[model samples]
Target: MHELTNETQGARYSPTSIRATWDGTGSVKDASRALGFSRAKGYDLVRRGEFPCRVLRIGRSTRVVTASLLRVLESGEPEYSGGHTGHCTS
Candidate 1:
């Protein structure tokens, strides 16, 4: 999933609204913006392979899996386990 940040060079968006929105795929910048991280940091995470989700590369474009991100945020755990392990009150 993609994390959104303030530095993304695109339309303005609120964090909560973006988090609640899902489209299955997003660019690197879009993910960074959603996660509130700098574009530079987002790329850095990609380079270090520390990002919690997988990134899909098609040609020169990179996209984050929105479902995985939403799952992690909603459950506070990775998405590979088939079910969320964390509890959400809301």
Candidate 2:
């Protein structure tokens, strides 16, 4: 997980860029960046239980399962499918 610096606020947040390979875990923003998902839309998908990748919550932190993400990206189907569209969101 890479920590991206916000120049406007000098704040740091995790957002996995495309250049960075999936490493089993990352923030929602990270997955968002990987899939070109807007921040709001990414969280919305999570809240709706329809995100393309698996979301893991630990306390206040949210993690996207890299393996699951990769599966979806490679196959357009979530590993734990249960009525999800399995469509890649651009």
Candidate 3:
């Protein structure tokens, strides 16, 4: 497999664009863009436990589950809205 570089993902830190290379999981930065958040805001949300999804700490890094993200997308539900009562963050 070809390794990913900034050029391949486009614009180096293009969060939205980086989703293409992600499979089962992705970083907070990538999920932030997918969820329409700025990087700082994403980290803040993670800290507050209000990121609209689970943020798992794996050793020295964090990641978001891509399957859960897809569930939200396929359901067409609004994320991070106060109306969220169907799901809980763990």
Candidate 4:
């Protein structure tokens, strides 16, 4: 595992660390951690089709595309902006 740093304060993942740690695809949990969010929140994002990167649903398994993750991290922007329009219950 590689250590991800938020040196830039707003940076979600360390591009270098991600590049060194993942090649093809990574778990939503791991991607969420890299994005500074909880695992449950990650699943929620996926469930609502609001994940920042490309997500693949294979059978009952969900995978986050490593390249898309890297691209988002490197570019400092989300590929998808499916923001919630519903009221926040939290």
TM per candidate comes to: 0.57, 0.61, 0.59, 0.71
Ten-residue segment with the worst summed lDDT in candidate 4? 1-10
Q: List candidate 2 stretches off by more than 4 Å.
A: 1-22, 79-90
Error of 4 at 31 (Å): 0.3
Q: List the residue pairs that clash in candidate 2.
A: 16-30
Which segments of candidate 3 are over 4 A away from where they belong? 1-20, 76-90
**How does each model score on lDDT?**
0.59, 0.63, 0.63, 0.77
Overall local distance difference test of candidate 1: 0.59
| Winning model by TM-score | 4
Best by lDDT: 4
**Per-residue lDDT of candidate 4, residues 9-86 (tens digit):** 334357777777686888999898888788999999999888998877877898999998888777878865345355
Ten consecutive residues with minimal summed lDDT in candidate 3? Answer: 9-18
lDDT of 1 by residue, 1-90 (tens): 134443343334343545566567767676676565778887887676555555666677867777656655556564432133452313
lDDT of 3 by residue, 1-88 (tens): 2455534644433444444566778788877766666889988987876777655777779787776565554564634422357544
Query: What is the TM-score ranking, best to worst?
Result: 4, 2, 3, 1
Query: RMSD, each candidate, Å?
Result: 9.6, 8.6, 6.8, 7.7
